[model samples]
Target chain A: MNLLLLSPDDLRADGSAVVEDRRLQHMLQVQRVEPGQQLRAGLLGGLMGQATVQQLDSHQAHLTLLLDQPPPAKLPLTLVLALPRPKMLKRTLQTIAAMGVQRLVLVNSFRVEKSFWQTPWLQEDSIREQLLLGLEQACDTVLPEVILEKRFKPFVEDRLPALAAANLKLVAHPGEHPECPRALGEQPLTLAIGPEGGWIPYEVELLRKADFAPVQLGPRILRVETAVPALIARLY
Target chain B: MNLLLLSPDDLRADGSAVVEDRRLQHMLQVQRVEPGQQLRAGLLGGLMGQATVQQLDSHQAHLTLLLDQPPPAKLPLTLVLALPRPKMLKRTLQTIAAMGVQRLVLVNSFRVEKSFWQTPWLQEDSIREQLLLGLEQACDTVLPEVILEKRFKPFVEDRLPALAAANLKLVAHPGEHPECPRALGEQPLTLAIGPEGGWIPYEVELLRKADFAPVQLGPRILRVETAVPALIARLY
Candidate 1:
């Protein structure tokens, strides 16, 4: 982990924090941190700075906090993605969070297997852990919020309109369409990417009704894990 | 698998092809092919077309090839990447191949763990298998050639010059480098990406001597798997 992320509960009243659990394991095994060493650390949803290691053991490490630097700015984006398979979904969570995407809406698509919706990885804690890993990897502090919409048509018709209001709405589909825009001056955008076999025409039409302009990333198809970052990087 | 890639050995004198092994498993289990069905197919490193399933059994599938369309064009790029951990390397191979990067060089970096150089994933058959999966995913026929340079200084100093000759050479380093270029009109280019913690100053200097201008992908540090496609997409 690039950043040592601490929850509020980890903080003591004396401006010190005690880190345990997986972070502690990483410190002991991966980092081999020393008592006097300072780690680039951040509080969850808060500031980022350094934490000087005060004491260490198998159980926990005591760290003094000095968070002052603001976290990096999140993208002005709300990604509306088809729920990928469980394996890809895990990586996509981390990928999106690392890229500074702050809002995500996972929706159903025709090609998305019904079995995908039943994965335990969609659990709240499981999702947060993956996002935390992304935040830690990128040295960011704030967590990206995730929303689930198991029903496609209702979410597109009832909910997506307001969520996409006053933003550039786009759906990243393959085939003949305009090239995915580059560095569009950091405008707030809601981009929907489809599943493996792509969104059927009816689904694309539904997204179109929500004012999402269809876009393409050329003729070559990419896996969702690869495409997410590619699309984000090209945008801004 | 999107494309059933046939090696020359699989071809019969009568223009029929026999596929068995893992591709057969995928065809039977996932695709559920019938006796007279057509699927997109391609020959390894050659043209792409369709395969009509002539017969199917648990052991093999006999297909008739009708190759007319050429595979999609490869990018005018050569990517030099630091050897990632084995798990990431597997995905990176598939990703680069899928994105039409026909040439890749995996080299050493100071930050790269020594054990990464020893991974079985770097073996010829293993690498080819991953690249084939990528080609199948993207509906392409060409396989990317992968070269290994275990020594850092020698490859960058001795070999990289010729490899990067007359191409737009770039190194995707983090920090105060110029922003990465976009859509340079398909000129031949060479890009080097570092391992997890990024390249040290010495390595960057050696690359600089070889005419590799340093470039940045903004502030967020992405995993290597994410960054590869990101860089490729933006460059093209």
Candidate 2:
């Protein structure tokens, strides 16, 4: 873990906290923390700074926090993705979070298998845990917000337009379309990426009607896990 | 698999072949093959075309091939990476092959764990299997070349210079460096990305002395799997 994330519950009025969970285990084993050592640390949903390790053991580590620096900037974009298979969802969550995505909307797509929705990885706590891992990996303090849309049509027709208003809307679909644009600098954007089979014709038409331009990478199709980072890096 | 890859042994002089392995299983169970079915197929390191299924069964698939089309183009770049852990190595191999990288050099570094050199995934057969899977995933037929450098100084000082000659030599490192360049369409390039813990100071200096300009991908430290695709996408 690059940054030790401290939840509000773990902090006191005097800015001291006791860590005894997985974070503690990571600090002890992976980081090999020592007493009097200062570690890069941040408060979840808050600022980041250094933490002085006061005590260490198998049980817990006593720490003193001084969260003075603001967290790194997030991308001015909202990602609308097809719910991936459970295993991919875990890593993708961490990938997007580490890339500094501010928001994600996991919407249903025709190609998304119905069984994917039943995965426990979609649970709020489970999602939070993965996002936390991403934050720690990136050494960022902010947790990206996530919204779920199990029903595709209603979410697209009723809610998406308003949510994506004023943003450059895009859908990463394969076939005869312009290449996905590059280095869009500061433009606010909302990009929808499809499933392994890609968006069905009807779904693409619906998104097009909603003003999302279709973009292509190339003749070769990339797995979603690889595609997300590629698209993100190219865009910004 | 997106494209069914056929080895030379799987083909005959009459251009008819029998597939009885995992590919057959994928055709039967996943693709749900039927008699007289036409499927996308490619010869290993050769042309891609369509295969007509002549017989369907629980054991083998009898097919008629008319291979004509050439495979997709590869990137005009050579990737030099620090050998990752075995698991990441396997996945990274597939990813690079899928992304159309034609050559890769895996070198040792100070930060790389010693035991990573002993991974079974480094074996030629295992590496080829992963690369083939990647080619199948991207509907490309050609496999990328892999070069292993177990000793650091000899390879970087003695071999990398000639291997990377006439290419735009660059290294992906953290800390004060220019942001990586984008879209150098047909210009041959060579890029070196470090390991998980990053290149130590001495390693970076040696690379710099060898004429690889350092490039940064902002502040976030993405995992190597995420970084490879991101760097490839941004660079090309």
Candidate 3:
């Protein structure tokens, strides 16, 4: 874990904190942290800081908090992606969070298999687990908000206007000339990546009419998870 | 697996083929192929074709090859990347291969610690393993060539000229202006990605002087593995 994340409720009234969860075990076993050792730490939804280990036992550990800096900056880009396969979904969330994306909108597309929606990974806790892994990699604590949109049209027509109101919008599709701009100026961006087989023509057109320019990532098609990180990197 | 890849030596004198390795296991277990099933197949350094499942046993499978359509088109790009951590290195090879990258030039960089070079994953077999994974994903048969350049300067100055001769060269670094263009016309591409902390200014300048156009993928910095897919998607 890059940053040891704790919840605010986990802090004791006396200002000391006890960590008895799996994270504590990871600290003790994987990191091999000992008493008095300093660790980079954070409180979920709280400040990022240094923590000094004060006590350790088989089951729990205590530490003193000292928030030193502000939380890591959130990526200015918002990603709206078609749901990927469950295995890819886990890695995608971790990567998105690690890159500090503030929001992710998982939308349904024609190419998305119906069976994919049934995946247990779509569960709330499962989603959070992946996000936490990303945060750990980046040593950040804030979790990005995730929204699920089962229907494309209603969400696009009803909510996307507001979402795109303050952002530069782009959709990733193949065969569009000149493609999307690599460096979006200072404006916030809302970028869309399609499913494995990619968006149908009508879907691409809808997004385009909604102000999302259809852009190509060259000739080679990439898998959804790989494409997400690639798009995020270029647009952020 | 994308396409079943067989080495030239795997071909028997009678022109029938036997596959008894992990590829065979993947075909039997994951693909669940039975006799008479037709699947895409390719030779490692030869042709791609349709294969009729002739027979299957617990340990091996037999196939009758019918060379038809050629192998899928490869990415018209060459990747020059600083060697990543061993884990990332494995994924990078797999991802690049899956994307149909033709060649990989793994180089040294400032942020790339010296110890990363010592990883057993740098061994040929391990690297080939990852490439096969990528090929399986794309259903392509050709394996990309992985070249290592321990010293950056000589390789950049000597070898790059010949490689960049017919391609547009791009080096991914943060802070380049007007940002990078998303796609160049259908010429071959030579793209470079930096180490985790990025290429030092000197390295960036040297690359530029060596005819690589320095490009930025927006403001948020990305990990090397993330950058690879992102740049590939943008360029290819």
Best by TM-score: 2
| Pairs that collide, model 3 | A218-B236, A219-B236, A230-B230, B2-B136, B2-B139, B3-B139
- The regions of model 2 sitting more than 4 angstroms off are none
Q: Please, what are the lDDT tens digits per residue for candidate 3 over residues A20-108?
A: 98789899887899999999888887788898999998798999999867786787878899989888898899889888888999999
lDDT of 2 by residue, B1-236 (tens): 99989999998788798999999999988899999999999999899999999997999899999889999999988999999989899889999999999799999988889999998899999999999989989999999899999988898899999999989999999999998999989989999999998999898898998999999999999999999999999988
After TM-score superposition, what is the CA distance of residue B70 in candidate 2 from its true location, in Å?
Answer: 1.5
| Candidate 1, CAPRI quality class derived from DockQ | medium
**Which window of ten consecutive residues has the lowest lDDT sum in model 2 chain A?**
A8-17
Per-residue alpha-carbon lDDT of candidate 1 for residues A1-236, written as tens digits (9 for 90 to 100):
99999999999999899999999999999999989999999999999999999999999899998999999999999999999999999999999999999799999999999999999999999999999999999989999989999999999999999999999998998878998888875699999999998899999999998889999988777889989998988887
Model 3 residue A234 lDDT?
A: 61
Give i-RMS (Å) per prediction.
Answer: 0.9, 0.6, 3.6
Each model's lDDT? 0.93, 0.93, 0.82
- Candidate 2: the clashing residue pairs are none
Report the TM-score of chain B alone for all candidates.
Answer: 0.98, 0.98, 0.92
Recovered fraction of real interface contacts per model: 0.70, 0.82, 0.38
Candidate 3 per-residue lDDT, tens place, B45-164, comes to 567788888998988888888866666678778899998999889888988988888899999988788999999999999999888878766667778888999988888889888877
Q: DockQ for each candidate?
A: 0.79, 0.88, 0.29
Candidate 1: tens digits of C-alpha lDDT, residues B14-99: 98999998999999999988999999998987888999999989998999999999999999889999999999999999999999
